[model samples]
Structures are given as structure tokens and as C-alpha cells.
Target: MSSSIPVSTLRRFHRSTLHPRNTSRTMATKVERSPAGEGADFRPPWFYTVARVLSWTLIPATGFYGVFIYDFGDHEHVFQPARRWAERQKAAFLTLSAEEKKIVGNETASTKP
Candidate 1:
């Protein structure tokens, strides 16, 4: 079987699927002045502008304070339980006999393999 189409068939398919170019004069027209043309010169109220500037300034200031200056000590209460549990674990490990610690180390190594 020939896997070829005639050039005339391709041209006919393209012509049938192609959209017509826009010909309306309104599509090319530009408005001289809009109904709300007075708003073109509008500026936000003084307080609104001030608030916007303050918000933008505070956003970065707050981020910088949190990252570099904020005392994490003030929030330690939130992690107190986890911190206490870790301290207890460390103390318990410290109290273990040297032989017990060696056994733990050996067990840990064997578990990995």
C-alpha cells in the first residue's frame, strides 16, 4: 500500500481548517479616554501608602529578627518534654557499665549488617 497523499488533498485540508483573518475596524481602534479616566491620576490615601510601606519593611525585619536575633530560649518551653527525654536518655547511657556499653556498641554494629 502507498503511504502517500496528494498535494491537492493537503492544500484542501489546510484551507478547510484555517481561520479567517480579523477584518473588524473596532479590533484596531484605541479608546481616547475611558469612562473612569479620572482614576488614571489616582494615588492611594496617605495612610494606606504608609501602612503598605510599613508592612513591606516589617516583613523583612521580622524575618531577619527570627533568623538572627530572636532568642530561641524564650521558646524552649515548647520542646521541654523532648529535651528532658533526651537528657534522661543521655544520663541512662552514662550510668551504664563499661561492659554494658561495649555490648550495646557490638549490638548496634551487628544490626547494621
Candidate 2:
């Protein structure tokens, strides 16, 4: 190694070392956002994942409530003893007149031969 220094290069370095710096302006700043560099208007991949999970969870829950919890299956009706009795009473009240019964009996007698 050599320990020699040049005179002209030393003077140029001394001149630049004393220069002033600007302190009036500052660097720009912005709000924090997603890693994809999208602003508030952007929808991330995580949102899609959460929405899919929510939809999948809710669909089965809705079906369960509709099928069991809400008792939509019980909306259909079946005839019981009371209904049968009422229907029998209605038929009895609407029975054929005596003249109609006589005519039916005459027809049966004629058809037997």
C-alpha cells in the first residue's frame, strides 16, 4: 500500500463537503393498504374466501331451519277422527230423497231380469 495523497482532488472534496442541504420540503405519504397495492376500492382474495365460507355455512343452516326448525314439513295436513266424523255427518245430511231412492230401486228391479 502507498500512503500518498493528491493536492487538487483534496481541494475539490473539501469544497463539496461544505454544501448546504434543503430542509423546506418533505417526502409524500399515503394510507396503509393491502399488499396488492390496491386502494379502498379493491376487494382482496381473503374477502372472497370469507364470503364463500359464509355462504356455505348459511345454506345448510337455512335448509335445516326450513326443514326442521321452522316446521315447514308439518304444514301438510292429514284427516283424523274429527274430520272423518264431520264428513260423515255432511254426507248423511245430503242423502238421496225418497223419490230418488224409489226410482233407483225400480231401476235395480228392472235390470235383474
Candidate 3:
């Protein structure tokens, strides 16, 4: 049976199970966020958002969605939150730096595979 399973797949499954799924949302909002009026510029980093979702089986909220942009200068567009990414305060976001805070702040157009 082990031979039929890819090592990577096994690792992923094991990791996910180990983290355990959160049954926080059975019907209402799937994700959660900080209360209104925390920080005017309060938004989570991109990687941080992803990590938050990945880390949890179900995201508590969907405050803001960001898409990665290429250029790294004045031409570059970044940090836009239509919703709130306040939930990032959970371990997944706090670790990031201010610069990271900036990049992730931008609204993402796509997360294409």
C-alpha cells in the first residue's frame, strides 16, 4: 500500500491531518476578521493569507484578497484590501515584516495555477 502512495502526497496528507481541521463555520461566514477600526492600513500579507488558509482546514473569514504583481518600482501596484484580513494576527501573519506587509496589501487579480 505504501508503494502506491507518493511520498509527497503522503507528506501533504500527514501535515494537513496533523494540523487538524477547524469546524468553526458550519453555515455562516467561513472566515473571520478583526473588529472594525483596528489599523487604518491593517491588511494581511499575501503569503500570510495563504498560510492562514492552508494552516486551517477552513478559513474563518475572507476579508481581503490580493494578487501578486511583477514590477518592483513606482510602476508596481500593491496593497489593496476590498475586505478585511484582520484574522492574519494569528501566528501565520505576525511573523512577517513591514515590507511584506506592503506587498501583500495589494489586491490580487489572480491566483492561477
Which one wins on TM-score? 2
- Put down candidate 3 lDDT per residue, 1-113, tens digits, no spaces: 34888899988877655545533342113233434564323445586688777767443322222332233455434442311234354556557687776666653434433
Q: Tell me, by lDDT, which candidate is best.
A: 1
lDDT of 2 at 16: 50
Candidate 2, poorest ten consecutive residues by summed lDDT: 22-31
Better of 2 and 3 by lDDT: 2
Candidate 2 Cα outliers beyond 4 Å, as residue runs: 1-41, 72-113
By descending TM-score, how would the candidates be arranged? 2, 1, 3
lDDT of 2 at 11: 74
lDDT of 2 by residue, 1-113 (tens): 55467867777766555334322221111223334455433665699799999999999998655544453343453434445576688898889779989999999999996
What TM-score, to 2 decimals, does candidate 2 have? Answer: 0.29
Error in Å for residue 104 of model 2: 69
CA lDDT of 110 in candidate 1?
94
Q: Compared with the true structure, what per-residue lDDT tens digits does model 1 show for residues 40-102? A: 324445977899999999999997666555556856655566666867888987797889989
Q: How accurate locally, in lDDT, is each candidate?
A: 0.66, 0.62, 0.48
TM agreement with the true structure for every prediction: 0.26, 0.29, 0.18
Global CA lDDT of candidate 2, please?
A: 0.62
